[model samples]
Each structure stands twice: as structure tokens, then as C-alpha cells.
Target: MTSERASPRRRDTWIVLAAALLARLAVVAWAASRFPPTADGTFYHRIAERVAAGLGYTWLWPDGVVTYAAHYPVGYPALLGGAYAIFGAHPGVAMTLNALLGALAAVAVHRLAARAAPPGAALAAGLLAALHPGLVAYTPALMSEGVTASLVACAAWAAAWVRDAVPLGARRTIAARTALLGVVVGLATLVRPQSLVFAPLFALLALAPLAGPRARRATLGFAALATACALAVCAPWTIRNCERMNRCALVSVNGGWNLLIGADPASTGAWSPIKVPDACREVWDEAGKDACFGRAATLYITEHPGAWLSLVPRKLAATFDYCGAAGWYLHESNGAACGDRCKLGLGVVETVYERGVLGLALLGLARASAESRARRIATRAVVGVGLVFLFLVHAWVAYAALVVAALFGGRTLLRGPVLPAAAVTVLGATLLTHAVFFGAGRYGLVTFPLLAGMAGLVLAGFRTRA
Candidate 1:
């Protein structure tokens, strides 16, 4: 009898997922036509072309000099280069790879959700991932969003499996899980260096809760294993940078430049090169340029702490929503080359995904174990519809309400407060990083899986009890 019921729901879930994938493919095709590959896509493609020609991660300028790049990490270009080598240097090849990554990311979302939440919530999260506008917008591009999100999704899944699905007692089990997360994070950092921060954050979230001397020993072992694995993963690139560039850049040289951009007086606290000091621009080499920018940024922050403090709000606003006025750019601008209907469709999808689905998920995240099917359904529908509609009509109140509800709503269940706490921590950590450094919705996209896990687990009391 239980199998019969589960069989139908599983069938329905697949149907939704399949339809979502088809829709995403359609989106990718449409996007390819309307959007000529630009920005990071164009740069990545150039680097891939160079690499394919045995140039070894280089770029040829208009003046005809072959120069290597260190600002952007080489992992993404390497992926593109391999794809070009196999598929013959066509735009479609990379986009197709991106499409595959997007689909896999959706599947990872489902798996991660299942471990953290109930079946219904997992299904909902999967469907949402399939249709999310941000994922749709960037995944087709030759940018790092799809790849980074895919890797992060894998980490989230491993974290969930270790924490909620499997009991954690043995040091070996803990080390294995920590190492898995470290490898994923290290690979992601190769694509986007900032991802390195998550390795320590994830380790702490995973290992900090256990009690007693044995638990402490296991936690130490877990941290050591994770650190060793992450550093080992980064070793090749670090050595290459040290040898080839004669610098200590572990991942890339963009960090200092990015910080300078975010900290300058004329920067408006978002993304801007306008305030980068002239001396920094005079530096020709990547290492020298980064050093110049780092010095400039430090001087500014030291001299004018008030200015730095004020920029935090601007950074935050630009982080969540790209502040074009401050020149914080997005890969694809909203409604660019898209029709009114397309704009409306994208807007509605993004709004619903970020606020609506996410809001309900937060409100339901801490549900108690004993609940009837009718109550569960009611809770889901009422919370979801109400929050979504309010968010659509009035974003500020709805969003504030989301934060408040996530923090204060729902009854405590038998499960430890790990999931919710970790969700908050991940989101908080991402926000804090961007708020202090630079801000773009794209930059903070790592939080999506964490949010999905939290939301998918909401109101899952009936399934848990059963």
C-alpha cells in the first residue's frame, strides 16, 4: 500500500522535472538567439580558443601579442577548452554543456532537498529549480554560474546526507564527508576563488555540534582532512601561479582589484573601476596591479572608515538587485532584447522563486513531526500563495516578513536545529562577504541551494511522522 502511493508521487515528480528540463532547453535556445555571447562569455570563449590551439591559457590582443590571464581562474576556461577540443570550437557546444550542468543542478537540488525536507517539499524545490529565472539566465552563458552552482549543489547534498540522512559517529565517516565537501569547494574555488571561504564555513557547520572529548577529536580530524583536501586540490594552481607568475596568488589576482573597486570613494559601494587610483592603473603586470589596488583600497579604508561603513548598504542593495546606477552589472540585463511578455515571464518566475516559494519554505522549515495530510496541504497552500502574492504586490514588506518568519515562525520538531541554523549561517555568510567586498545577485547565487533545502523541508511533518 505504501509503495503504491509513493509510486504515483514519484512518477508525478519526474513528469514535472522532465517538463522543467524541456522548458529550460527552450529557454536556452531562445537566449542563444537573442543574446550574442558577451562579457565573461566572450572572454572565456577567447581563452578556450587560445588553449585549444596549444597556447596554454592565453589571450591575443588586437596588437597581436599572446598574453596569459590570471584575473579569472583557469578552471572555467579549461572546461571550455576541453569542450572546444572535443566538439570543434562552436558556441553551441559550450551552451549545450551549460544546459547539461543546469539540468544536473536541478537534479542535485532535488536530492539535496530530499535529504533535508519531505518528499513534497523536495518535489517543489526541484520544480522551482527547473524554472528559476536566475538559473535560466546565466546557465546558458559561458560564465561560471552554472558550473559554480552545480558544484555547490553537490556540496549541499553531501552535507545534508551526512547530517540528516546518515548518523555521524565515526571519525572515518566524518573525515570522508568533510573531504568530499572540501573537494567540491576547492573545485568551485578554482572557478571562482571566493568559494574557498565556504570550505571552513561548511566544516564548522558540520562538525561544531557534537559533544564530548571523542566528538572534539573527531571534529579536529574532520577539519584537518577537509583542510588538507582543499589545499591539496588548490596545490597545482598555487604552484603554477607561483612559478609562472612569480606571485603568491593561490587562485587569481582579481581579489585585490575587486576589493579596491568596492572600497573607493567614487565607487558608490557597488561595482566600479572609476575610483581605482591612477597609480593602480599604471601597473602593467597582474601582480603589480593587484598590489597597487590593494594598497589604494587599504589606504582609503584606513583614512575614511565612515565612507566604508556607508558603502555597506549600497553594496547590499547591489548584491541582491544589481544597482546599474552604481555600475554593478549583471551577465544579462533584465528585459534586454526580451519582449514585454518575456520580461513579465522572467520577472514573475524570479519573484516567485526567490520570494514566494522561498518564503513559504522558510515559514514551514521547522514543522513538528505530528500533522495530518489535510493540515500539511493547507499549511503549504495558504503560506505559499499568501506570501507569493504579497511579495509580488509589495516586495519590501513580504521580504522583511520572510526574514522575520524564518527566524521566528514554525514549531520546533524532533530534529536538531542544525538545518535552519546552517541555512541562516550560509545566507548570512554570503551576505556578509558581499556586503564587505562587492555585491551582485550573481555573486551571492550560492545561497540558492541552501534556501531550497530550507524551503523544501518546510511543512513536511506528515511525511516525517509517517
Candidate 2:
């Protein structure tokens, strides 16, 4: 019948999309049943309930007592609240939404990888992302990681589109894509303020190919648009905070404090167990006696600069150690923790066993020798993000682990058309950073998608070679 002929590309995309959706649904169901509620989940869940009950952006205790002391951003809770409005405050519904977003993220990754590599590579990347254990675990939780990851992936995809579409002599398409990129980045910032780090980088990267007089103007315009969108989304909470607390903070006020805690000798090291007053005072000069716990950490860092310098390696190690294991890194033992004691069980052991020693060794070597173009680009981005966190936040093992994972994971994913050099560098970075710092399992989740993508690429290459 000469009815309708679907293009091969369209058909392939639809098939991949359908498959991704099914896989995500399965992950959502598994996550819903397999994992118990986590600490952050409880916090976000309760916050969402409060939001649903018209508490607005104000944090409150279960007893209806107002508490602005909580350090979390409002994006995830607000999303959960919207879900609660429709689904009646059920955690499962909220999780289902996360699962959906995660699936969307897989789709985005697939498109990006496919454009950069090949269709098969894209499909493999999408499948890996959908089935990623780390992502699966967080998909149904009340936490923001899954949603944030999705947002990041979406932003990356948007950036890729802007980059590719502009060069193909599509000016109109470029403008629209750039606008969408701005919107996506803005949305990502709302979810996690840290995403601001990538906004400028992406803008600069996107403008690289644009010619002469138009490039600068386009870049500036896009940057301004992105900033405006971000401010629009975040300004309400900032205004509310200013009116209520006289603090004109656009984001949360916990960055300095987190940095102080992460860099403090007393806290980052052995003194982590002890609750010392004035922990944050040195870095934040305005800190008072009651705020001494926060100042004290800063004071230690300032007074013992040499000691702190020496401790950097250790801090890096600790950041990558078991301590970075997402919610499991918490010291307290609970059903929600991200450690072996938590509901998820020992994920580190599981990863190690699943990956195997030989595979791990090969990955390690690959990461060490990642000197190629793709590896450099991905590593630079990872390093830039890591540096931002290191300077602005606290240098933790988890952060180190995150950087390594990104670097290695990106290399691994790209290794099919390329060699294993990038992967090796990423692994080396992760191990060295972890060895010198600290780590936790959850902290490693950020790179899980990359790892899965890399594994798929490696497998595909082996099959091809064989």
C-alpha cells in the first residue's frame, strides 16, 4: 500500500525510545520495591508533603514547627509537591516521575552519543543509562540526584544540539536550540545551583564555531537569556529568604559552611566525630559564638594552613572512599543510609564483584593513558567542574570520586571508535584522588551512567574486533 512510509531514522529512533521507556519502567518498579526510604528521601518527602499542604517554600517540622535550618534547595521538593498534588502525597508517584525523568535522560544521552559516535553506540549508551544500578537506586527516591542527573543530561543534549545545528547553516534552528539550551540550563540551576558551573562553559563552547561579528553578539545574548531565566526561577525563593531572614542569598546559605566542614582538619580528619564550636568562624568572619561550630572549622584551616595543605591529599582520599556513597556516606546507621548497613546493602562490593579484578585493572590502565582528543575534552570539563567544587565547596573524597568517574566514564564510553586512553586517565584520576582523599559509594553515582556507557562501548568493540 502506498499509504505512509516512515523514514528509517524515525523508525529507529522510535524503537529505541520505546525500548528505553520500557527499561525505565522496569527500573522504576524495581527501585520502588527494592530500595527502602533514605534519609534525604524522608527529608524531601516530608518537605514535599508540607509543600503540598501549602507550606510554600518554608521548611517545617512534622509537628508544624517552622525550620529554615535545613540546608537543601527547594527544586526537588517543589517537584515532589507537584506530584503530590496530583498523586496525593504518595512517595511512589513522586518516584515514578523521577523514573520517567531518568528515562528521558537516557533518551537524551542516546541522542547525544549517537550524534557524536554512531546509532548503535547511541542505543547502547541509552540502554546502559536506563539499566544503570546507581541511577536505578535513586530513581524512586525522594532525593534530587536522579532529577539533577536528568537535568544535566538534558542540558548536555541541548548544548550538543546547539553546537551541531548551528554549523549546518541553520541560523533559525540555532537560535531556537540556543534558547532551549538556556532554558534547560536555567532549569538545571533551579535543581542544583552547582549547574551554574557548566552554563558559561557550554555557552563558550557553543560559540566556538560561530563566525566573527555574529558570534560574540549571539553568545552574549544567550548568556543574558540564560541568566535571566535562572534568576526568574530562583528569585522568588531568594526574595522570600531576604524578606523573612534579611539574607539576600540567591541559593542556599550552606556553601561556605559545607566548605568549612569539608576542609577543616578537625572535621575532615579525626575530629569529624567531635562537635567543636566555632568551626566555621575563620572563613566566615561574621560567625558568632552560637555559630562557632561552623566557624571553628574555618578557624582550624586558617590557623593551620600547613596542616591543611598536608591534609589535602587525605581529604581527596576520603572524598573518594566509602564515605562518598551518596546517602550511605552518613555516619549514622539507619535504614536510609547509603552504606552496607543501609537498605541497598554493600554497593561497593557489588560493583567490584560485578566488574571483576581483571576488568578493573584494564579500566585502570585505560584511564592512565587517556591522552586523546575526546579524553582531553571530557577530562577538561570534568576537571573544571571538580576545580569549581574544590575551590567553592569542600575538597572531599566523594567529589574526587565524582571527577574520576566522569573523566574515566566519558573515556570509557568513547573508547569504541577511540582507544582506552581516556578511560585510563579517568580511572587513574579516580583512584589517585580517592587514595589521597576519602570516598563514599553515593558520591560515585554521578559517574555511573558514563561507566555503563563505556562498558557498552567496550563490549561492542570487543564483539566487532572478534
* Error of model 1, residue 392, in angstroms: 10
> Once model 2 is optimally superposed onto the true structure by TM-score, how far is the C-alpha of residue 401 displaced, in angstroms?
11
Tens digit of lDDT per residue, candidate 2, span 277-359? Answer: 54333532222322454455566667887866776565554443332243352223234423445434545543443243223
TM-score of each: 0.81, 0.70
Candidate 1 lDDT, tens digit per residue, 301-411? 899999887888677666554312101112243346655665455555565566754564446532533245554555444445446545444332333333444333323
* TM-score (C-alpha) between model 2 and the true structure: 0.70
Tell me, by TM-score, which candidate is best.
1
- Residue 377 CA error for candidate 2 (Å)? 16
Residue pairs of candidate 1 with colliding backbone atoms: 117-457, 319-440, 361-455, 364-458
Instruction: For model 2, give the 10-residue run with minimal summed lDDT.
Output: 416-425
Candidate 2 lDDT for residue 83? 89
In candidate 2, stretches whose alpha carbon ends up further than 4 angstroms from where it belongs are: 1-24, 27-36, 61-64, 67-70, 168-173, 211-225, 268-299, 318-350, 353-440, 454-466
